[model samples]
Target: MEPDHEVLVVGAGFSGLCVGIRLRRKGVRDFVILDAAPSVGGVWRHNTYPGVAVDIPSATYCYSFEPNPGWTRSFAPGAEVRAYAEHCADKYRLRPHLRLNTRVERAVFDEDADLWRVATTGGEITARFVVSAVGPLDQPKNPDIPGIDDFAGTVLHTARWDHGHDVAGERVAVIGTGASGLQVIPELAGKAAHLDVYQRTPIWVFPKVDFAIPTPVRALFRIAPPVQRLVRLVTAAASEVIMVLGIVHYSKVPFLVRAVEALCRAHLRRQVPDRALRRALTPRYGFGCKRPSFSNRYFPTFMRDDVDLVTTPIDRVTPKGIVTADGREREIDTLVLATGFKILELGAMPPFPVVGLDGVELGAYWDEHRYQTYEGLSVPQAPNFWLMNGPYTVTGASWFSIIEAGATHAVRCIAEARRRRATRMTVKRGPHDAFTRDMRRRMRGTILAQPSCARSNSYYFDRHGDAPYVRPQSGLHVWRRARTFDLDDYSYGP
Candidate 1:
């Protein structure tokens, strides 16, 4: 089949929109953005759980190119973030090229035709290039508790929150104490008659430094956009310092980890003065072994009379309530599962199968080759295709930075292919292997590679117990590297 367009982007969220915006800026307009959902904002749109807001400062969590001057708070809420995505779509005039509620099932590279044959719910569309921006955190995971389906009461996963289900004056059981659980538990604690929080493992909680963005500051950002950029740079620098010194080198610099641990302990002590409660909340694993959460009210919410923290391991679930390993049953009217999303383990090949050259499925290839890729954007055998937010691309810094870097890299690659009038472009196997070797070497002594994470049930690690999701370097390094595409790393063909 001849190419229907120059490019076909498989997502409509931050990474996808960034691709469209960058492509348009580079004078490439023959492309379409397709999303499975009826709306934009991949994670922001799905996770409308109560008290959900950005953990990072709003100044740094946004696009470096497009600064939002009107954020109400230092950390914008999910709604505002979704609106910002919509604003970006409008600003870039992307709606005309966006196909919502259209899911791309599979995309196979036609070796002979030199085009990608994409199969979708809407219809099959061939393109010269395919950009997979389906985010890592888009797929929500449910717990594997026995008899989970037997729950007679309403069951809701925070990712698939049922707005219609009323939990007011009802006994609510929230499973998991991850980021989403921390945010939602606080909000639900106020409304539920009684809330039972099931915690399989304790998470390190830090005090959130959130406040309203004053009117004057917003006005200043509008008047001088450079001020907003300055704020972003400052925020980025601070985060980078901690990441490089503290997290990336936790084992080497114990004091750096201890200092942050001291702050976390102080926050917990201040919030929960009760000795027993504080002990229950104290994490046993290293600080960076598991993902840290930030919230001002999460600790204090436990002090409330209506909330109960249940650390007992769940044995099973009855039709009426949950059963603990201690053989105790707690009845609840509503169940909220905040189990979190499946990161990096996007079902081998997420959304659908992607077959590259010689009818080799991308999933099968990765399974045999161990997720080797060139800068997490292009795979060795995946010709004329790139994945945004792929394995080893996620970092400790703001997600927007990762998206921007990847989108820029992919757009430049496509532009180069067009400039050369090449029918196909595939990453060289030598570069892909070299990148993988470096990733494994750099990951040797990191916090995630430690023994503590083995039992932590952290999504950071791949099936082989290796943490392949994190980019093993500073966010700034990745950003700069992505800006300058190494054309020598790829092979162009006619």
Candidate 2:
């Protein structure tokens, strides 16, 4: 059987769009970008809750090749970011190659033909190579609470937010106080009649340095595009200093943590005047253990008269409201689940079984053996299969840079395979194992590897308390390594 396409890219997000744009530039036309959603943007499309904006600075968040000149603020809002994703798809003329609302169910490797048999909601399609760009935090996580289904008033996850629902007069209950929760709570503070934020684990909150870009500045960016690129470079370098001092080299200089923690405390004290509320919001664990949120209004929102910070252990969810362990039931009309996503087990299976060599299901194999990828791109047995935001590939900052790095690496691999007249290309088992081992070794003594991480309810850890999701390295480190194409690392078959 002939292949449907030379390459099948599963997802149309930042990583997937990068693949599409780069493939077109590389003169590779036989490819299609498939997305389960009706639109292009992945998380940006789904998350449209009020006050939704990026945590990272907008300058460094964009592509190096396609620097956006029209960003209104230093930290762009979610709507603008989503529009940027659409702009990329349009600018690259990728719409012709996009298959929207088509979810890929399963993809199995055909050993004999050195091809992939991909099954989707539409039908079966085949490709010579399969690239999985399904993001790490795409799947929304619903809390394991009894009677969650019974909550009849209104139920919504932050990712699947219902904007039409009238939150103006409703008593809203927001579960979890992570990044999403912090952003959403501030927006709901004024609108909701009463906002009860359930905090199981307190997270460190710092001030957000967000400001609108003046018209003259934007005009200058439009005229001199290199000016914007220079700004991006400067922003990235500043973030790297924080990554090295506060995160990567934490064990060597422990005082760095104390200094950063003091700054966070000062920020909190300046915002919240009440001692009890300040104590409730304060995080006990060391900084960088879990993801710290950046917001100017998150702390001040708690001071509002209508808002109630609930620290009680939730026993279960009732139809009316939440029942606490102390038997106090706080009745609420709406439930907003800011609980986050399944990160560690990200994209393990996409609705159906991904059978690789010897009929090993990808999900079950990962559950037992954990992720085994060569530089978080190619696996040992999965030939011509590459994952975009795969295991241990996520850096400390500059997400777009990381995406670009992975996309370029995948594109290079495909080009090399074609040059060698190879039908199958897979990472050698030795190199794959060595990389995974090295990542584990490097994780030792880092902030995430410390015992304090257990105190924080972060999605970084697997079942055994090991962080299989984080790269534990700087963005520059991964970016440089990805650009360095080492052909000896892979094994090719004709």
Candidate 3:
């Protein structure tokens, strides 16, 4: 049977765009990129709240191939990141191949035909290959709070901010002190008449050394691209040192973790003078248990008289305000939910049903088998399907590195299938199992396996109590493995 397209990339985010660019470079033009959003940029496009910016240095946050030399700050703003995505789509000639506002509902494999029947909100389409690039953080997870719907005041999620609404002189309350909340709280402190911040778990806040990039440096990058590459290398190496030594090799290098914790504590004490507030903000879990944030203003914002940090547990929500466990109600005119995205959840990973061979659904398989993937790209029983961000795929390195590695692996398989004129390509179970076992063995050295992580309340650990979100390997090792992995691990058929 003839498929509608040669490949169907199931997202238009950085991961999807990277795969599309790779496919195009391979001279494969019969492909399409589908996204549920009305436009591109994925998370960057969705998150436009004030003070939204990259947590890492701008030098390391972008694609290695397409570095933007004109980043205004060390950490580029969300709008610039979105612009970069649009630029990539335009430069790579992916505009024509994009089908925006199209949500994938389900995908079922047709074994007899060796094709994928994909059902989307726009319509149904068949393709020879399907790449799930929906990303780990695409779907926003609303808080499971009682009487949330009964709130009469304006409610906004950090992921879906309402720009038209005016927040000035309004009594506002921000919930969840994660990355988004860290950035938003500072911006909202002076703007709102009175702001209340709800904290379920305190996070380790590191000092962000941010500054504007000089024009001459930008010019140097454009004139001599190698300079930017060097800068990127340095930035990446610094991140690798912190992540690998403090988190991945926690059992082996406990001192590095303690050093990082000490730095965080010193930064907190410097920014906040109130010892009681510092104690309230200090995290109970280990440093690497949950992802931390970098900010110069986050800790200082709590010192504002207009801002009040509410550590008390929220009992319920009234139409006008929030009720606490201590029989106190704080009236607010606006509510902001920084509850974060749906990660480590079955629904968000695929965001839809994907039926593979022998009536096995991808989510169901992960649920039963504990989320295993071969090289975090291919899986057994799922022929010609790849994931951009699969279980144990994300290294603590820059997201661009992860995307490039995953795309390389997926593209290599697709290229091999094309060369052999094979319609069905599935990873062998033996290799998959072996890889899973290796990852499990390496995971023992990471901080995720430590007892202190039980208090983290992190999304990294799944319901099965396994932190399969991160690959237990160095960035360089992951990149090398992606480029040189044995193709024989997969079985191709006509």
lDDT of 3 by residue, 1-494 (tens): 89999999998989999999999999999999999998889889899999999999999988999989989999999999999999999999999999999999999999999999999998999999999998887778888889899999999999999999989999999999999999999999988999999999999888999999999999999999999999999999988888888899999999999999999999999999999999999999998899999999999999999999999999999999999999899999999999999988777766788899999999987887798989988888789999889898988778899999999999999999999999999999999999999999999999989999998889899999999998988899999999999999999999
Candidate 1 residue-wise lDDT at 182: 85
The digit string of per-residue lDDT tens for model 2 on 1-494 reads 56999999999989899999989988899999999999989989999988899988999989999999999998999999999999999999999999999998889999988999999999988999988988876888999988889987899899999878989999999998999998999999989999999999988877789999999999999999999999999988877766666776788877887788898899999999999999999997888888887888999999999999999899999889999899999899999999998777635433246778988777677767776578878787688888888778877658898899999999989988888988899898888899989888888867887788888878877766677677878888888888895877999887
Winner on lDDT between 2 and 3 is 3
State the C-alpha lDDT per candidate. Answer: 0.87, 0.87, 0.93
> Per-residue alpha-carbon lDDT of model 1 for 1-494, expressed as tens digits?
56999999999989899999999999998999999999888888888988889888899878989999989998899999999999999998999999999988889998998999999998899999999998887888899999999999999999989888889999999999988898899999879999999998888988898899899999999999999999999988887766766767666876888888899999999999999999999888778777887888999989999999999899999999999999999999999999988765536344468889878888766766577678988887789999887778876667899999999999999999999999889999888888889988888767776776776777777676777778788898898898875897999998
TM-score of each: 0.97, 0.98, 0.99
Give candidate 2 misplaced runs (Cα > 4 Å). Answer: 346-352
Which 10 residues in a row give candidate 3 its minimum summed lDDT? 343-352
Q: TM-score of the candidate numbered 3?
A: 0.99
User: Candidate 2 vs candidate 3: which has greater TM-score?
Assistant: 3
Candidate number of the best TM-score: 3
On a 0 to 100 scale, what is the lDDT of residue 213 in model 2? 95
- Span of 10 residues, lowest total lDDT, candidate 2: 344-353
Clashing pairs in 3: none
